[model samples]
Target: MTITCQEILKTHEHLWQEATVHPFLDGCKQGTITPEQFNTWLVQDYQFVVEFTRMLARILSVAPRHHFDVLLGGLTALKDELNWFQVKAAERNLSLDVSKQRTCEEYSQFLESFARTPYAVQATGLWAVELAYNQGWQLPGHIPEPYTEFADRWGNLGFTDYVKLLEQQADEMLGNASPDIQKEAEETVITVAQFEKAFWQMAFNAT
Candidate 1:
């Protein structure tokens, strides 16, 4: 079987399951996540988003000409995403100034290290991070009231399509990559998946 980028990612399905079905997400889906827990996640995630945007900018700087528009679209989306975080924080009386948790710090470092790497590896990392959230929240069943907004932000069709586009882009990049680049890209995916689990664990711990 010819292994594709998504197939390489799926090889770590166990880790993805641990990440997507985490207790934190379960709490969100049930509308039972405490304010403190939600705030912790929101604030830590805001920190991640800041780094994520930086990573996206770095990727944009190095992405191939063919991939420019799609990457730019993602960069544009991050601006609104940051605004949404701020708005939601204010509505919940939550301060976005909360310190970054250990997981967030580690994940930020991981993403930052890819700043000048091959675009294929960067795209793989991006796909892994976004897919983790999308798959986690887009699970079957209604998301309860308080968390519906959060779910929709990540799980909505627009975001779903965006992730799919990223996936396709990553696969295209990987298809022409050298063997070493392909190996590195798969490693990046697994590492990001592990980070996804740690991120969820950090949120659950705050509860």
Candidate 2:
């Protein structure tokens, strides 16, 4: 009985697609997003990464021993990623200390709640969240300037490869879990998709 993330993704097919290709990404591709709007994502997402990195560290601590190497790589990349976000924000004169918008705050709180879930749930949710960004930025059509570099940051081959690695690890975790844990993990993926969609929408709609 090998359960898979693909099964969960297919279970919520419409939501999976919507979460990854929402209007915000469409705006990004068309270069319709203003600098202020971009700042909303930059500031909020940097904050989200901080919490997400913490969650990855927690997930690493409890994940199966064989999964450590990949989780460690994720943690390391996040350290560099935090720095990358800082540099990008500074270059654009965006402040990173602003208050988290409602969606961002709720998402951060949600990530923290993973402390109570099984490793399967944590790992699967993490994979789903990353997949959304990878898909969103990798969308067809030219991404205008500044946004092009950001797109490359997440949508590039390297990042896509990394996300694939994560998907494999998460699926492996889910496959070996108990029936209850597997079901919880699948539900967690759906929750992550909902949050991903909201996070993107938050950026585009923020005043």
Candidate 3:
């Protein structure tokens, strides 16, 4: 049985909704989130990105030749993301070094486990992860001032287009994968969605 990324998303659409729609994002949209809340989440996300960058590198090492350009470009963006975080942190008087919260550590471990998975599995999983952020921030429509940058960075036209490319890549990879690989990829999306949801709650609770 062949599975496309769309089918995987459709099958777990409820879980996807759970991960993407949350009070945290709602707060962001409403402009009710305090600087402390936002900053805490930003710091945690920076740490998450650090691990995410590592995962991207490991997955790229084993990625198919055709995937080289997209995956490599993703790494470059991630590098810029880290520097962006530092610049933002300095503006807020926030420190980049801090303890990883329970959810962040668990999420990191979850991402790490995918390192040895098949390329199809990793690519599909990566798509699910990015799509959550893309939709999560975009779904809210109008974001007020101050917080617009956060949503715009991930939800803007450029990022949305890039995510579509990722979707196409994952779908192409899964189309040629074994049934077992497809099955694992579906499961990987579910697991990643769970972490995404938890990470949002963790950030919200910090407020």
Candidate 4:
């Protein structure tokens, strides 16, 4: 049986589960995560998002002409997301001036490595990163106060739909790719999943 890109991704669903259902997310859901830890995550994530926005722009630059609108939408969302992070950090008295944690830095490096890759590879990495967050917060349960906004930011139906669109775009791009490119895209997805897990663990441990 031929494996679709989505099916290839499903093979690594365990990593997604490990990332999204992590203890940190559990703490957010139950309001048990300490203020310091939450702040740490916010600061580190803000840094990551800054790099993430750059990554999006990089991808947008190389995106096929037909895919410009979708990629541009993502870039616009990142700009808005960055603004939200700044406002929320101020409201919570958390400084956004903090440095990126080791995990975040490494993830940024991983993203940078895709700078010159094919569209399929880039889309696969981007899709994996977004899907991890969408699935993580969309986990079935009542999201507690404070964290509710955070959950809605990434886990809402609108975002979920957006992710699905990106997934489809990736699959379509991969459809005509060479076998070697397809394998590279799969590796990118797996690496993204692992990085996502590490990112959450970094937040949980406040390391």
Clashes of each: 0, 0, 0, 0
Best-to-worst order by lDDT is 3, 1, 2, 4
Worst 10 residues of 3 by lDDT: 198-207
The digit string of per-residue lDDT tens for model 1 on 136-185 reads: 88883578888888888888889889999999999888888888888898
Q: Is candidate 3 or candidate 4 better by lDDT?
A: 3
Residue-level lDDT of model 4, residues 75-178, one tens digit each, is 88998999999999999988788778889999999989989789888988888899889988889466888888988999999899889888888988888788
List pairs with backbone clashes in candidate 3.
none
The prediction achieving the highest TM-score against the true structure is 3
Residue pairs with colliding backbones in model 4 are none
Model 2 scores what on Cα lDDT?
A: 0.85
Off by over 4 Å in 1: none
Query: Across residues 40-70, which tens digit of lDDT does each residue of candidate 2 receive?
Result: 8889999999999999988888987888887
RMSD (Cα, Å) for all candidates, in order, is 1.5, 1.3, 1.2, 1.4
**115-194 per-residue lDDT for model 3 (tens digits):** 87898999999988889999999999989888888898788888888788889999998999999999999999999999
Find the candidate with the highest lDDT and give its number.
Answer: 3
